[model samples]
Target: MSGDVRLEARGAAEETFVDTVHDLLDVLFERGSVGDDDQMLFRLAVSEVATNIVEHAQSREPIEIDFALTCDAEQLCAVFTDNADPALIDLENVGMPDADAESGRGLAIALAALDELTRRTEDGNTWILRRRRQPAA
Candidate 1:
């Protein structure tokens, strides 16, 4: 594990998925030196993404979701993969939903909070969230 850490987990995309991933995150960050603001952003983005998968990822039975978290000197990165109906992912020109709206805002929140928020479809769906510790000079 040297100075870097990577964690991987897979479970049904149920209501408890967020908590499961977050517990791993808490341990990883505690061993490092992430600031409060960056930590908060990471937690918020991860929670939102996990919740979105639980609610929106098109599935009849509980689908399996894979997670990875990497922390190193340059940045902190998160990757999530799910065997969801890939057609439901829409990452183009996303906009925040109204305050009264219930859906369509999770991606927006993640995008606004993280340095990089990207999604791709391969064997399934993948979302990557990265935050840099130092600005480019």
Candidate 2:
């Protein structure tokens, strides 16, 4: 709950809900002083995580979504949690989905955009994303 910026929402896991999640990231990047390039990459990585939850969570009731984005001297870190079913997604083994596949690419995109990306089953499902910050010009 405590971070440089924290965004929390409780709602149904539907595709239409992802834009609201993106708006949360926009707030974090703006207030937390993230630059344009870093903001773009962070947005993509976080969006993928949220999209995966919406499409796969299969929650009958509203699911809780939590996001924490922090910036330090070295890296930007994000932690996202959703009250969804425990899903075993192996980042190492999950290859790029086919070009024509509509789904199955979220994890891959997150993995590519993040310096460190990991998923675990905690109080539901949690995804941690970290990216090293480039030295200032």
Candidate 3:
């Protein structure tokens, strides 16, 4: 579980977000490490991040997503990357805006769903998401 899958897209708009997530999920499913719930959560989290890039990342720059699934006797890890500017997002302040708000909940949900979430901007914003896969019975 120390392999990586690298995907790149130029001018990927919101219309292609679902396809990206599906592609990632298909890879994970093919590896036989992702279960039903894990698949759902992965799709949800990836979509949220991808949508954020499409909506707020300013330029329609090329997006690079690197999914690294690593497993030992403990857990699984997924890392995503995009070339969009990261300064626009305030990760520390992710919260529900209000009960009637239509947006602003995706990031919070993603935070809660993933066991570990980390974001950093070097050349571009990179998000690392980790979750513990269930042990074989």
Candidate 4:
């Protein structure tokens, strides 16, 4: 893995989420591995996963987020893992909200922002997000 960065935190979901994203972006920026568009997408995806952990994963023991970034032969990839229950989400049936709805849009936004998305349940839910970087011209 090329460009790997990992972060771990435990606290109120919102603060931890924000800190995690900021740290991830800081690493990307330091490596000059991301562009404006990539940064925006990362923000969107990170928010989506973090919100899911806060809202769906009911845990009083503080949420744990493990975030990693890496590069393979094909793309730059991000992986986020949490120990919260995976059963809270119905991935196949992500119901849409009304047009006037103010929330429930995060999953859709995350799906659209990433080039590849996958979820798996082992110990908990692991969200894998992949974005193919443009080849240098």
Q: What's the TM-score of each model vs. the native?
A: 0.88, 0.81, 0.73, 0.75
Judging by lDDT against the true structure, name the best candidate: 1
The regions of model 2 sitting more than 4 angstroms off are 1-11, 59-61
The lDDT values for all models are: 0.83, 0.75, 0.63, 0.68
Provide the lowest-lDDT 10-residue window in model 3.
1-10
Q: Count of backbone clashes for each model?
A: 0, 0, 0, 0
TM-score of 1: 0.88
Q: Measured by TM-score, how close is model 2 to the native structure?
A: 0.81
List the pairs of residues colliding in candidate 1: none
Clashes of 3: 0
Global CA lDDT computed for model 3: 0.63
Report the lDDT tens digits of candidate 4 across residue range 1-137. 24444444444555557566667667664565556677678667766766776677755566676766665434656677777666466666665689999888888778788787788988877888887765654
Residue-level lDDT tens digits of model 1 in 38-66: 78888888889888888788856558999
Better of 1 and 4 by lDDT: 1
Residue-level lDDT for 57 in candidate 1? 86
* Candidate 3 Cα misplacement greater than 4 A, ranges: 1-14, 60-73
- Candidate 3 residue pairs that clash: none
